[model samples]
Target: MGEELKVIVFSLAHEQYGVEVEKVRTIERMQPLTRVPKTPAFVKGVINLRGVVVPVIDLRGRFGLPEADYTDNSRIIIVAVKDMEVGMIVDMANDVVDVDSDNIEQPPEIVGGIKAKYLRGLAKLQDDRLLVLLNLEEVLNKSEIVQLEQFGE
Candidate 1:
């Protein structure tokens, strides 16, 4: 049997995206955010979750997609990479699936408007569905991680 990788799949702008389950700390419902000025446009702001003020980023803006209104399906995916935690606003928090490592293929130049560097690979699933596995470290730059850490301090 091929090595298995568990992923937390989420939807953004109608495209399916996945992040390693280990990197996903929690999945939360949409919550009010405190907007911080002079930050990157993609950085939606911060949210207070259980006494921890976490920085939130809109995946739509981070991936260069047009912003849409937050609907009932909207959710915040709190992911931790290298000791930094940030909330990623996604259209939906879909499924938790196990993907075969061998089934994951190299990503092309781009996938759904996001650069290849930000992606780990593509997993081919049932019914011709594709999961864009994300390299969380690459998805959130070092500076952004540092900024998020400051919020926690």
Candidate 2:
């Protein structure tokens, strides 16, 4: 069998989540955010990263969870999807975890009313904590994102 997939895990609303490490470009501190009007509530705003203006999405609100106050551990996880570099804000970034394919199970039919389509899988850790593996593309690919672009145009 091939080697296991490595993921960078993070926390949001006290729940553990993860995304493929390969998809993650970097983790940066939360910077000044510029709000975009008429966009989805989950889209916190945009920030310029080294001259690249990237949209920042708040994972807590995106998942329909209560908004969380940013703390010292808050971070923006920069992930590359296709040709776009997006930033996802989370309560705190945990660590990179390696899990065999067998250890990752398909997301259940229901996750607190969240569609399984947004999830890549579910990783069970040795410590008995569950990590909801996120499907980066699906989670961030919303009509509102496109609408925001039109508004700016």
Best model number under lDDT = 1
The TM-score values for the models, in the order shown, are: 0.95, 0.90
- TM-score of predicted model 1? 0.95
User: Candidate 2, TM-score vs. the true structure?
Assistant: 0.90
Mark the regions of model 2 whose C-alpha exceeds 4 Å error after superposition. 148-153
lDDT of 1 by residue, 36-142 (tens): 88788999899998988889999899889999999999999999877778999999999999999999999998987889999999999866899999888878989
Q: Between which residue pairs do clashes occur in model 1?
A: none
Per-residue lDDT value at 127 in model 1 = 64
Q: What ranges in model 1 sit over 4 Å off?
A: none
**Tens digits of per-residue lDDT for model 2, 24-97:** 98999988999988778898888888878888889888888888789899999998876677799999999998
